[model samples]
Target: MDIIGFLKSQFLCHLFISYVFIGTGLIINLIQLFTLPLWPLNKQLYRKINCRLAYCVSSQLVMLLEWWSGTDCTLYTDLTNYSKYGKENAIVILNHNFEIDFLCGWNFCERFGLLGSSKVLAKKELSYVPVIGWMWYFLEIVFCKRKWEEDRKTVVQGLQNLRDYPEHFWFLIHCEGTRFTEKKHEISMQVAEAKGLPKLKYHLLPRTKGFAVTVQSLRNVSKKFYTEGRRSMSAVYDSTLNFRNNENPTLLGVLNGKKYHADLYVRRIPLEEIPEDDQECAQWLHKLYQEKDSFQEEYYKTGTYPGTAIVPARRPWTLLNWLFWASLLSYPLCKGLANMISSGSYLTLTVFALLMVIVSVGVRRMIGVTEIDRGSTYGNNENKKKQP
Candidate 1:
């Protein structure tokens, strides 16, 4: 492996990267705070500026994935619809199975020029996940409690806030609500049986409440993008992604201590036809999962999905964007701080450090609190094991 890949694989490197990403993210967020006074004057301009700032910070990881790991990403899509990807606002429905699916989606957004404003309806716990989570806060990404009753209103409010956003964006939603596991799949299937819906072999039962609410909330305001529907928009929607097979020790994986295949599947559907009724939407989502399950089965059996094409991953301007901000912002901030400390502003420095520590701790605690532990069950083994 190359030196960058080697460095990425080391445990210390992991920590270092985490720190760099988080620290840089915090600094950028702070800069964004400096723009609060501008919100009243030109909300659109302020938002656009924030998107550029976000691009700078987030591109570091994208660079890591694209260059350091040397992983390959292949897109499968019809060429007709490639143009419309980042030109308008849209909702992205994705299956939640892999740890890095969000990263892949972000990569695609970057390719289509939507990286800066890309959003997701993520579990609230992800909001505390250091760099990425911290970055999402300023981007106005929606977070959900995953409890339908409590989340319904809050999530809708969050989505509504994006209606007037000046920039185009891709709002990702993992209707499944959690990463897939064998046990979770079984439990989801039981929920399916209880609801008299078809069981999915590849995906867990999506918490329809989230998908339903997302569509209902954003339908009037945002266009819906399905993996299959991108062609209709004249935007080439790529459906395949190359992931480092964590199960197999690629040189990169061995170094990085990651153990899961970076499997990705994407399709595009248009926004106009999304069902309005929650129940119908739920059934449609379940059926889609069943179809996806069948696709996975075929893929495993044949070592390729049924699709006929391979589309190369497109590298975006995210790296240059990162470099631009790092050069422009980091030096000025450092020099300013040095001057402040030299001028007897030690107390100010101390207070800033203390505030950083407090915010870090608070964010960490919030993450810990929001995570759902599915292992514990309230019933007997057989019944408990069947529910998640």
Candidate 2:
């Protein structure tokens, strides 16, 4: 193995990378706080600054996925429609089946120049995560508790906050709400049977409340304040993702330098086609998911999406950004370790070791997001539990 490849596989190296990511992320979080005042004065300028700051931290993981792991993300679409990506605002509905699916989503965001400003409908618990979650707070990422009563207001407010956002971004909504599993699928199928809907072979019954609320709320933005001669939500990007070689990519796999092939098929649907009423919108979302299920089945059976032939070129910016962070952080870290060792103080070494242990535990907890067995049972019942 090459030197970097060896480092990618080591837990100690992951710990060091996590240290730099979290440490620098915290500093950026503080800077984000200071920018709060700038928002009222110059909203666009404040947003632009935060977008770049968010890029600094987000690109680190993008590097791990693209550069370190060398994962290939193929975009399947036509040239005419594919050109619209990253050029305008859109709502992205995606399947939550793989642990690193969100990472793949981020990879696409990076390739299309939207990594710095992309948003998601993340669970409320993720807001407490060290680096990524903390950064999301400043980005105003929409967080839901999954309870219709509570999340309704939060989702509306969050989407409303983005109405005047300066940069173009792709807002991701994992309508399934949680990762897929057999038990969840069985439960969702029961719900489908109860509702007289078609059985889904590969996906869970989507939590319609989130999608309904998001579409309804963003619809208001479109009607009220259009930007750049277009509605705030100009299009909906229905993205279906699958892994090649039946590989289930995980955060640990990426840390260990496991290369996986990701094929994402995105279809652009106009926003006006979405139903405006809550009930009608909920039905529309359900239908969209059913179509997504068919796509997944087709992918498994034929290993390709229907009529999708476009795969965008991956960019080197993510790798360059990662190397910048590594170069900037590695020297100080090595110097600190050397000083601690030369001091001959057993206490310093002990404290350092203890900190490593704590951070390692934290990283494991972070990795829990990508573990299928460790996933929550949100959609396993006829009535979905509110995501915590």
Candidate 3:
């Protein structure tokens, strides 16, 4: 193994990287806060700058996935449609089966040059997390409390504002609504059977309301949601992602330099083809997920997505971006530690070490949230009201 790669895999190196990520991220958040006044001066310009700023912090994790851990991301799709990926806005509906799936999605966005500006329909709690969450606030990422009654107006207005987004973005939706687990899947399948819907072998029952809200009215809910002049999504990218058979990669696994292969199968459907009625739209999503389940089954059998694989070369910029941050931040950290040690201040060193331990704990907790096995059980409750 390469010495540097081995060094990066070490626990101390991971700690340093985490420190730099959180520290620089907090600084970036401050800079983002200062830009709030500029929004009134030139909203488009403010947004454009925030996109790049967000990219600076977000891409660190992307680099960790793509470069540090050396995860391979393969895109499976027609060669003809490949040219359009980063050029237009898209709604990406992906299976929620893995802990690091969102990072994988970010990797794709990074490859296509959209990491900074990409959006997601994330849980409301994420909007308050330290670095990543605060950055999403500036990126116009929509957050939902998972209660449609409370989220409908907020979600609609957020979607409406995307009509004037300054850059091309891919809005991601984990339509299964929660990550997959055997227990959750069992409950989800029960709901599927209860509703007389087809059982999904590899995924949870999709919460239809998010997709339903996108295309049409949520009957008996918010009829006004399908507004005049509401911006249409450019297209729907039905994305099915899977790790190589027998490999289940986690965020912790990636940080530990466990390389894994990811295959993403994408099928783009035009906006006009999706039905405008809520019920029809729900049906469409259900059928799409069923097809996705079949793809997963075939993948486990064949070890690849069902198409010609188009794996993009990992770009130097992600590595360069990460190195830039490390160089910019590490010198002061090392120098301060050296000074403290040389001065023989045991108290200062002890306090600093304790602080580092605290930061590490926080980072570990952040990683914990991304693990699907430990993920929030949003859609598994049998008694909870079903979404449209």
> Per-prediction RMSD in angstroms?
6.8, 2.9, 4.1
Q: What is the C-alpha lDDT of each candidate?
A: 0.63, 0.83, 0.83
Report the C-alpha lDDT of model 3 over 1-76, residue by residue, as the tens digit.
7887688678788788888898879988999999999888988889889999999898998888888788998899
Each candidate structure's TM-score, on Cα atoms with residue i matched to residue i, is 0.74, 0.93, 0.93
When 1 and 3 are scored with lDDT, the better candidate is: 3
Pitting candidate 1 against candidate 3, the one with the higher TM-score is 3
Better of 1 and 2 by TM-score: 2
Worst 10 residues of 1 by lDDT: 228-237
Worst 10 residues of 2 by lDDT: 222-231
